[model samples]
Target chain A: MNIPMPDFMPALPEMFLLGMTCVILLLDLFLTERSRVVTYLLAQSTLLGALLLTIMLYDNSRTLTFSDTFVLDPMGSVLKGAIYIATFFVFLYSKGYLRARNMFKGEFYILGLFGVLGMNVLVSAHSLITVYLGLELLSLSMYAMVALQRDSVVASEAAMKYFVLGAMASAMLLYGMSMLYGMTGSLDLTHINQVTAAVGSGQQVVLAFALVFIIVGVAFKLGAVPFHMWLPDVYHGAPTAVTLYLSTAPKLAAFAMMMRLLVDGLGGLHAEWQGILVLLAVASLALGNLVAIAQSNIKRMLAYSAISHIGFLLLGVLSGTAAGYAASMFYAITYVVMTLGGFGMVVLMSRAGFEADRIEDFKGLNERSPWFAFMMLILMFSMTGVPPLLGFWAKLAVIEALLGAGGLTWLAVVAVIFSVVGAFYYLRVVKTMYFDKADAGAAAIESTLELRVMLSANGLAVLALGIYPGTLMALCATALSH
Target chain B: MSFEQILFYVFSAITVLAAGMVITVRNPVHAAMFLVLTFFSSAALWMLLEAEFLAIVLVLVYVGAVMVLFLFVVMMLDLNTTLLREGFARYLPLGILVAVLIAVIMGLAVGQNHFGLAQVAAPAPHAASYSNTQQLGELLYTTYVYPFEIAAVILLVAIVAAIALTLRRRPNTKHQRVDQQVATRREDRVRLVSMTAEERK
Candidate 1:
């Protein structure tokens, strides 16, 4: 009853971005086709302004606002900054593609901004209700974005599938949450943690059931195995630009959701949840790696690759240690960087009539453009977890975390074996680019200079980070420690 | 049994029967009507539990708005009931398995033994003058105002998404462009006659 008026400063970035998104939505309506640039510029500046505000409002100590529904802390600030940077690059890459297809409109930018806002709220959520609302907003925006190219029946079908499955998963999550609420008498994560820590094993049956449903929901969101039927279809069916955006930043939000519900909220149930996560991780690793080798479509292959990467991400969180959490964060950030580049290349080579989504499309890419091919090589190698690449270090961090868990040595071994299997498909992409003969009159790269520069930077940055992982690893450690 | 207990049993039985009919009815409109009945009976049952606000809201929202929308869509679509029922037999085994599993789980967690009157004392009824709605409103607006605002934003998003998805510019339909009309210039509409009149081919 005596909760003071909560300080609004912790929420300024979200508020600022929300207001600017609305202003741009209105401002775009009045602008002519020739002046569509204004809308794009406004959207870009909104992200920049939000990033600036996030840094300005950054606090070393954790702050809870909105009556303890929202949290602003080092982890949230870091993740928000990553989302902004990733979205900034995604928007820049999407422009030329949209313009070429006559799909350049304000809706894409507006929906993307809303999606970012959803991710922002999700990463900082301190309550079950906040997490649910944030997840819905993000999922809705993504569904709309997937169906943005209205003339494509494939896109529409994919959107329908994604929406239906996503809704069902969310309902399961809510059902589990209701059970937890009944048990704990609170929806606040901190309060739930406190209540759960004191509960006896007599409630184990109900708790185990709740954990299963919650894990199912989280696995579905992360595109882990058995719950990942929608991923390949949605990824392959959406516009490559939308796919690029969807695959990159949303992973961070899902990671935050897992951290909140599993770590912050229900740490007392770690034994049960961790067992479920291990099963999901192994299943995802096996199915993802094995199925990816058979896929001829590049998007579907990457979708499977994403599934396998999620398995690695889970290895860290399943460890249930601070070191593991920090490693998982590092893996998520690096995965986003690598995915942006890999999908960016797919977007770059695609033109008005060409989708450039087949494995053979990259044949002899080196002969066409050696520099771009090398950039892709860096991305592919990093994804394969080859030594001296960013992905290698990401995997190593999680493996070490698992080893430190002491009892999960078998899981660590399984992860390493699957990573080796995963390497084959990634290497095949590189082989297709360098050794295979070029098709007659293969389309030339006609992307804008901005996209080209950004894509190259995105790819090379993985290499740069691989060489200097110390700073970023330490940053993750610091963020998770607080 | 007392009159209140007898009424409770009657309403709950009706609610269960209607809910069963909602899935089993052959006609789509009939199914929707059964759903409305189910909602009404459930609302009555909530009233028995002294949750007047929940009862009224359930009736007003579910029976009034949501069921009407469902009926509208069901009527608008020309669905073939025989074709819809074609896969029912094929999937019956799987469906039954799932149903049985869910029943067992629910039984273990919230069956009569866990939720019976013996386990939970009945809440004392409030005076007739007391208002459940006012208490609900006070808590919603004060303690849960953040979620209320978030719900508003979600509704706004639904509106924007609906319009964005369905609204389209049809090329077959012709409409005047106000921008072109307003930006009209003399040269754009009609050229000067100084040297153009004699140049007809």
Candidate 2:
């Protein structure tokens, strides 16, 4: 006659973050500009505190609560922990940059914190409705964040583009989800998977149509080629602080969404959606690598690079194997680290008048400061998939997963070639930093000791992980194995 | 046709006609009014489907509330819609192409090829005693509670974001502050000058 209540323990971290975000929002309203640093502290502590809560609540088994729409699993917890770390760096690096440009406001931090909460929800989503809800929550916050710099025409345009396209994507996803519901008679992924797996070819045509729409929606969110039109413009148009927030953390959420929808929900249609991912992966690799070379703006270049990394990320997913998913997860973590460091450097170089977003801005970084130059070198090299960096192992893991999948070897070759071409652009960055002469009036490197130390450590993590990538990969493997 | 079928066709046809008029009408206010009619007809069609909760909510929310607010906006904006639609002709072919594509795809999606009784068997219809509202409420409060709360957060974000973007403290603007007005006293806003009458000379 009555159902048991859902467990509150699995969702403790999300609950904690949401409460703190509201508290910080109110706290910021009353504080003067001089004490506004408290907001930053509170937001950072919220992330740290959530991370702690997640660690405390971590269990090896999948824990479903809240009507089984939300599932806290090994993957969700690990990915959420990754999101927290990435967002931590985003806020830390954005502090000086936003303050210098007079764009520092409580709204940015509040929205960013909300974005993190959205990503957290996204990572744990277990049902069609939860997935869409999380995606919309994440998307809306990003739209607001992009348009936060309201005075900038470019930013406003970017926000408009992102909003329109994101809404269209959400519609496609909802359409697909409703179709699934109609066909399978359930919105829960576990039930959908069982029904779909048993239905076989009974309704393959409609199922394939639904699959296409879902793939399109997922690809759009992941910024794969063909649906990646808004990524670069949004990245380049947004304030650097916003770009810093946009480029990190959310990738984990998007990745989790992919796994939940494609791998878990529609695993029965692996034959259909696998091919779609292959096409997206190849196109993204070719187009992203080739196009990034022509980009003079560093933000646009990184956006394209994000696309290429997504290509690699898809390689792991499309393999439809535990090893491949783990590889993808490993790749996502490494990419986030490299992107954070890369964008952190961009933010560090920027000051009041100059936006260090142009490729030329990195010229003679060695002359400016050899230590940070070395740091940038490490990040660029890692991005190039050079050996002895975390990125190299990530690429190898995916390529190996492709080989493990037997017929995906050619796709792996395509990925390898694209990586080689990708190296040209990433290495060009390093070359410019080391080879080119500093501008005559180039100012000396200036930043807080804290940013310098954290950034250097960020760079070193890539190298350190490259030397030993087992622990993270094992974590990813275990998360997906169950 | 039976009377119910006849009424269903009438409402659906009106819904389609009004929807088309929403886009083609020259006047923006006319378009808004057309949109309202479209909502009304759609609601009527839903009423025929035995989904009273949805039908009532559609009429109450979309037709009664949203459309009225939309009409007010249209009447207030005084838009130069003729100038705005100048490019409508240029984009008509592309727009038609997309619309046709979507129509065909949607037709296939819900069409007989995939969704008919012959292709996929339909579930048994609900009994007269079944309450769609009760079922929906059970799901919303139990299994879908997470999404319900997330939706609340999203609306909160929307409210915060809209205010953040549009609200500004310009100090230069001439808007009155109610708090300042309420705080004013005899000694504050009115300095009791002893020789105020002499100033007129």
Candidate 3:
């Protein structure tokens, strides 16, 4: 058989990332521990370069590459740009935390770069094998990152659970793919669509089973209800910086993937998957909100809160239209900003040798640091979907899409109720800061001026996006239009 | 029988036997090793089926990289073999039940011929120029692109999750912040002084 030569020009982002990772690795090896700043700078610069390249190469019309396994278009560009920007912030936010933990090695930056590359590949993937390759690359890198803190028992246990569960999810996805392949005699989405369209209603049941199996993988990635058992423990166990990273960029990528797979690939059978997504959405909303209220740990609470947000995001997908896809994309972008800001606040409050993870840790914070308290207030409000903030706009877009789709009023009511319930925990953080007494023995909350400035900008962006969400919404809509 | 048929049976036997040993091996390391053998033999079977690309990749990735990592971890860990054996008796009934159920399911699936195995014609000696991998590649690159991408995104999420889990804060360590390190200049952290004997006092 003749070997297919891949065209390299369309793979610019991945190639850039691969090159950058190697350069960062080399720099880390030559530089002293104190001089590891170069690695961080390199990572940020590389991400910015890739983001720029993605924008420059943005094509509204779909252009398949590598024999049709990858497609470059508006959707790919938007997702890639968002992921790159998120990774940039993730690097910035992680610098202080990694240094504090003495895990600020070169491998961190390399792995992160590779992970970004994987995400880029995933967002553009046009075939099953390419998808698996991209996914495995990302997964292997992540497993290494999770076990970076080799000495922690909790970290190890979290890693183990994540690995086992992740493997199971992957297996389910693979099995689903196999079934689809067997049924359609092709792995291409277009071919499958043709085959599925031709098949009678009787074959829909098999398709439904395959779709459900595939959705299981997506739900697990989103940390929605029933598949959410991993989130709280993983979040609470991981470093605050890592948690910040986890809660942001990857969610956007996952949403992009779900849209590409379910909405585009299996769109002909939306009736079946829509019901499943609705169930997942309602359960995620109810369980995520109800369970979060009792959590004392800030990270764990946010994890649950994230699960609930996944429910809202799923609402957008359930709409099963271009508008729904746009809303989901919009929700993902808003979530990234809010989550990063929230986790950034947690990082700022933390001092060396002391983790500011518990809800009580923020008590009396207003009295000591009014500025930080206000920032925290804005972040919490945004996360709680309070009006005039980014989170509220995200929720509105999703609900609007769901309503437009029609006949999901009960699901909408569940979402609204859970949003209200979710408000309690967000407000609880605010109350602790404003009304509760400060702990005398707590470590001083001193941070570098750079961190303070970045954190403020990050937090304020949420408010800015909330007030003028038109630009972001327009971008999301345009991205999904193709 | 033809040589090709004989070879197919040989690889098939090896694969099945290795797979069975993967479950029955008492030592966890041995079990893992058996799994590797099973993967290799199955890859050979794939080769026989004219899926050379997948067969080679299966060997390179699973047998080479994944299994090596598995073996490294299994060997490094101080596993209590005695403790493992102790649980076997207690879980024997449940394990047997599960094994039997799996066997029944497998039997039914193969017996029902739902996999279309019976419809697959015996491969001709000079098959089409387009190999299994080539067709797979064409199909994936062209049609199945969306699912492929979705899979990639799922993997990205998993990666982030793993990193987030393993990155824990330790209370006692002192490390330098990247921002602080970058902010410093030669003049700030280093001093060059020329001292005269009289001024030195």
Candidate maximizing DockQ: 2
Query: Could you tell me how far off, in angstroms, the CA of residue A381 lies in candidate 2 after the best superposition?
Result: 0.7
Tell me each candidate's TM-score.
0.93, 0.95, 0.83
Candidate 3: lDDT of B13?
A: 98
Model 1 pairs in collision: none
What candidate 1 gets wrong by more than 4 Å, as runs, is A1-4, B1-8, B112-124, B174-201
Number of backbone collisions per candidate: 0, 0, 13
Candidate 2 TM-score versus the reference: 0.95
Which has the better DockQ: candidate 2, or candidate 3? 2
What is every candidate's C-alpha DockQ against the true complex, given to 2 decimals? Answer: 0.35, 0.68, 0.07
Q: iRMS for all predictions?
A: 2.2, 1.4, 7.7
> Considering summed lDDT, which 10 consecutive residues are worst modelled in model 3 chain A?
A1-10
- Name the better of 1 and 2 by TM-score: 2
